[model samples]
Target: MFNLFKKKANEIACPMDGEVIAITEVNDPVFASKAMGDGFAVEPSNGKVFSPIVGKVTSVFPTKHAIGLLSDSGAEILVHIGINTVDLAGAGFDILVTEGDAVDLTTPLAVVDLEYLKEQEKPVTTMVIWTNSEGKEINVQLGKSNAQTVIGKLK
Candidate 1:
């Protein structure tokens, strides 16, 4: 029982299976909150959002935009599917999963209308964040390829 907490085995995987387009380098709280500032964003050319780690769907925003996932390893990841997409106010977005659902690494959570998003000039920003940042260290592995490629890993 004690060994469970003693083990340092918390490994958070990439939320989406896609090549990384952006990563979080800025450490400012203000910048991180903005739509186009800090945090990692992935442009999934495939238009599908996957669970980065095995966790419960904690919260699905009322707008049907962003999703909050709590990994079994205790990592909370926020997956925001597109850039300026919140402006759409739930338009052009289709959510397949709901809150409290158990999800795997390959479960499809939502789909963004890329064609419609492009018409609106919204950039997709998919962020995998360590919601509890006080004493945690996050390592993200990235690959060089198109958005279709699996490029980022978190550990």
Candidate 2:
């Protein structure tokens, strides 16, 4: 029964499949400067985006550029779809979840038209940030990432 009741991994999951780049490498100052929190950006290989954790969908930006999640432990993760794609006014994006929805790692958050974004001259660098990462433990791998990959554990 002990093994059955063992705690699940407390790690952040990849919201999309792509190359994971350090937040410091992101072009946006709000993200790169760790202003929002410590996380990474992904140069997405595809258009589909998934939820990074089992949490409550805190907010879905009206522009459809980002989704904010609040984990059970009160951690916040912001998954930004692109760099300044908000200018597109939700044209090239399709949000699959609504605010207050409980989502899991396998839940589809949104679908993006990467080609449209590319044609619009928008950089599809998705950034995932943990907003309150002041003095906590985070151990996420920075490299190639897949949907099921555990980016890192946070405490």
Candidate 3:
């Protein structure tokens, strides 16, 4: 029998093409400690960052180094591009979306200049974290990924 009150699960797509790794493996202590929340990281092969969930844009940092999304299933996701890249002050990032915009897996969140980050010696491990997940569970399938890859699910 189907349950009417059960909330449907939401799929999380890979935000970029790269090798997906455990969140604990991220170099940033804040992310590695899960002090922010749990999710995965990608050492990207290219510059494009896509949406990993279908939701409304909660916030896009002025530096264009991070974007926040509130999933339809009630999960808050923060897509932070590059470690310590924030200190660059948006020098090599291109913000493609704005707050309050509805975005799906195919939506381009931003474009990072990989070479610039490399020249600046910034770690280009992008993180997709759940900022506020107290009673929910997330299942992530880590490894190689592309923009449309189903990397995880929010339940």
Candidate 4:
């Protein structure tokens, strides 16, 4: 019986490779409003949605619009791709992963259509919320200054 070669896992990766449009706060609005209109909106941007941490896909909403990830460290992160994307009913989107699946840093979970999202006047507010906020302190890592980074580490 030889069981001594397992590599210790590391923290998960950032989900999106774009600017940090928004982060989870205490007073976040229930719904995002359009910048120029009186309705909910979302802006389309092309990018691969990645897993912020190594965890299980707890729940993938029926609309394929949002995903819930439970990190190995017991931090629950909810990643909402776009505004009102649920209304699109899975249009202009491609989901590469599924629920209960273990994902790593480089795993491509989904492909987003940002152009279509912008034409619709939607607010592309990528939200990263810790459902269990009392357990861990989340700190976001910022890149140089131009690139938007949403990477968070447990401290």
> 78-113 in candidate 4: lDDT tens per residue?
777776667778765688888989966556677777
lDDT of 3 by residue, 43-141 (tens): 999999998998889999988899999999889999999999989999999999999998887789999999999999999999999988767777788
Task: Pick the lDDT winner.
Answer: 3
TM-score ranking, high to low: 3, 2, 1, 4
Query: What C-alpha lDDT values do all the predictions have?
Result: 0.62, 0.86, 0.89, 0.57
Number of the predicted model whose TM-score against the real structure is largest: 3
Indicate whether candidate 2 or candidate 4 has the larger TM-score. 2
State the lDDT at 94 in candidate 2: 96
For candidate 3, what is the lDDT? 0.89
TM-score of 3: 0.92
User: Which ten contiguous residues of candidate 4 have the minimum total lDDT?
Assistant: 34-43
lDDT of 3 at 50: 93
* CA lDDT for candidate 4: 0.57
Could you estimate the TM-score for every candidate? Answer: 0.74, 0.91, 0.92, 0.71
Clashing pairs in 3: none
Kindly list the per-residue Cα lDDT of model 2 for residues 56-122, writing each as its tens digit: 8999999999999987777888999999998999989999999999887778999999999999999
**Per-residue lDDT value at 38 in model 1:** 30
